[model samples]
Target chain A: MEELKQAILNKGVVVSNGVLKVDTFLNHQIDPILIAQMGQEFVKRFNGKEITKILTIESSGIAPAFTTALELGIPFVFARKKKSLTLSSNLLSAKVHSFTKNETNEITVSKDFILEDDKILIIDDFLANGEAALGLASLVEQANATVVGIGIVIEKSFQPGREKLEQAGYQVESLARLASLENNTVRFLEEVATK
Target chain B: MEELKQAILNKGVVVSNGVLKVDTFLNHQIDPILIAQMGQEFVKRFNGKEITKILTIESSGIAPAFTTALELGIPFVFARKKKSLTLSSNLLSAKVHSFTKNETNEITVSKDFILEDDKILIIDDFLANGEAALGLASLVEQANATVVGIGIVIEKSFQPGREKLEQAGYQVESLARLASLENNTVRFLEEVATK
Candidate 1:
């Protein structure tokens, strides 16, 4: 987590009060080494319990989720944002609203992927309002699967995402927790706690 | 490569003459161990290329690309299909037409990521009409970077993708080459040749 925190401080761009752009290493442009380390960190954090599969949303969530699944030696399934023609009709879906993009997308996964006895670990790049995470959990529940926990690479602690997931009775583990992005400065939750 | 070919024959679903659904392991629901093996295979295939970075499109392309970048100890960048609010105006953009979806997407990458004198290896999940691969090559060219070659996980040999890329004067390495999908059977090019 130190490397990720350092990367955020060094390469992360604070666009505004609540927006932190980590396109250089996290989302748009990815550092595979760092991503693998974070995936290992997630594996270490969630050392216990059974995880049959790793679930995530499409695009940004695929890399970290993939790496974690690789480390865990499990399969990962990503929920597609748009329903493609190739996708089968047997699907478990949930509507998710993105605060960043300011649009609602119906994310879906094939019902054939998530089985009734499966234990799912949901992973994603960023957690702000918990809409995406909650939506993923809903998909797992629809299939009568067990929700293992939520693993996040970066969490905006100033937001209500963590609290919402905790309220929903899901364990949330975030590698990097942002305390604030005010005045063009990147602040970590641990840094603020030590003060 | 044999494992990949076997996986295709066993799990790959042929929707029609041209459409092969590999959602079971290659795309929708990903097998991480197999993906890591494919990544290592790519490293072996593109050995001594001096690749400084791995380039891929978002979603389906990220897994194999990430694993390849991890094996190569290089960074990987995925082009965003839709421009988000956080993305900057300075970008390297290209228009790619998706034949399956019957839509065109203007994929873009941050200008800060791709640089001059960078040796990039392009990776993707599927190669059909060569639109996505060509669009990716254009992005690298716009940045004045050198494209070492293109690595594809699955290539429809009967399609025009490889021919177009080869005619464009780029070396392409496809892991699994499909000769035909007629009569709902997955036929590999190697199998066809041996017969």
Candidate 2:
């Protein structure tokens, strides 16, 4: 988590008041070593939750989800933002609102992939507004699966995302939780243990 | 390679005349064990190559690329299918035609990621028409980077993708090359072992 916070502090660019751009290493270009470490840490944090599958959204979440699934020795399932022609007809659908893109998109996952008795963990690169996480949780509920926890690499803790998920009765864990980003300087939750 | 081929043969679904869906284990729902094996195989095959980075597209390609990059202890850079506000302003963009969707989309990567002197290995889930691979290759070229090799999980040898990449002067390696699909039965290359 220290390495992630450092990487973020070093490379993360504040686009405006609230946007933190980390394309250099976190999103567009990935540091596999750090990602693997993050995945291992997630496994350690959620070790005994009985996770049967790792779920995430497409595009940015795939890498971290894949790595975490590999570390936990579980299958990884990602919800597709768009329904491709090659995808199966039977699917579990949920409407997710992206505040950045300023639009709502329907995310679909094959009903065959998620089992009713399985326990799933949702992982993603960023958690803001908590709509995406809620949408994923909705899909899990649709499949009659249990959401063990929500793991995030970077979280804007000032936003309503954490509170929303907590209200939904889901346990949330973030590697680096930003308490505030006033004056273009990032601040952590103060509870993070420094290495 | 045998493990991959067997996975395809066992779990892969034949949709139409030309479409083979392995979403059960490869793309939609990922099998972590098989993907790890694939990462090891890619490392073994491209052992001596100076792979500074692993390049791939978003979504499907990210999984294998991350795995292979993990095997090689290198970073992975995935090209985004669309220009997002989260991405940097400066980018290397290419047009890719998706055979599955019958649509052409622009894929972009941040210019800050790939260096001119970097040796990149392109990784992807499938190579059919090869348009996506070539587009990714063009991105490397835009960065003035050298592509040491192209690693593919599955290659439809009957398609033009392999031929096109070879003609473009890339050392393309596919774990399982299907020679043909006769009567809904997949016939892989004779020398290529299916696990």
Candidate 3:
């Protein structure tokens, strides 16, 4: 987490009060070395949990989830933002609203992938309003699967995403927590002593 | 690459005459262990190339590219299909037509990521008509970067993707090459005797 925090401070661009652009290394362009470390950290944090699969949203979430799944030796499934023609009709879906894009898109996964007895760990790149995370959880629930926990790369602690997932009775682990992004500066949340 | 070929023959589904769905382990639902091997294979295939970075499109391409970059110890960049609010105006864009979706999307990468003197290796999940690969090449060319070669996880040899890229003078390496998908069966193209 120190490396990630340092990377955020050094390379992360604070575009505005709530927006932090990590395109230089995190999302748009990726640093595989750093990402692999993050994955190891997630595996360590979620140690001893019975995780049958890793679930994530498409695009940004794929990298961290893939690495974590690689470390855990489990398969990871990415929910597609749009249903493609190749996708089968048997799907588990939920409507997710993106606060940044200000649009609602239906994210879906094939029902065949998530089985009834499976334990799913939800992972994503950023968690702001918890819409994407909650949507992923819904998909798992639809298939009668167990929600193991949620793993996040970067969490906007100023936002309600963490609180919402915690309120839903799911454990949330974030590598880098942003306390604030005000005045074109980056601030990280101090680690809670209990965690 | 025998493991990949066996995976395709065993789990790959022929949805139709032209479409072979490996969603079970390749794209929708991903097997990290296998993908890591695919990444290793890519590194072995493109060995000795001066690859400073890995370039790929978003979503499915991110996994293979991420693993390949991890193995090569280089940074990888994925072009965004749609411009988000957080993206800067300084961008390099290219139009890519998805034959499967029957749609064209303008993929963009941040100007800060791709440098003029950088040597890049393009990685993708599948190669069909070569549109996506060519689109990525154009982005590299826009930045005046040198493309080392293109690495594809699966290639439909019957399609024009490899031929087009080869004719365009880019070395194309595909781990699994499909000869045909007729009568709901998967057939791999025989390996060329010479490298």
What TM-score fits each model?
0.97, 0.96, 0.96
Residue A52 displacement (Å), model 2: 0.9
Poorly placed runs, candidate 3 (over 4 Å): A191-195, B191-195
TM-score of model 1, chain A? Answer: 0.97
Give the candidate order by descending DockQ: 1, 3, 2
Residue B69 local lDDT, model 2: 85
For candidate 2, write residues B1-195 as lDDT tens digits.
889878888888777657888889888999988988999989988988888999999888888888898888888999989888666488899999897898989999888888999999999999999999999999999999999999999998889999999998999989998887656777787654332
Error of 3 at A55 (Å): 0.2
Q: Residues A75-185, candidate 3: write the lDDT tens digits.
A: 999999998888859988999999988999999999999999999999999999999999999999999999999999999999999999999999999999988887777
Whole-model lDDT per candidate: 0.92, 0.87, 0.92
Better of 1 and 3 by TM-score: 1
Write candidate 1's Cα lDDT for B1-195 as tens digits: 988987887788889989999999978999999999999999999998899999999889999999999999889999988777778599899999999989999999988889998999999999999999999999999999999999999999999999999999999999999999887888888875221
Docking class of 2: high
**Cα lDDT tens digits for candidate 1, A58-101:** 88899889889989999999999978888859989999999888
- By summed lDDT, the worst window of 10 consecutive residues in model 1 chain A runs over A186-195
In angstroms, give how far residue B147 of model 1 lies from its true place. Answer: 1.0
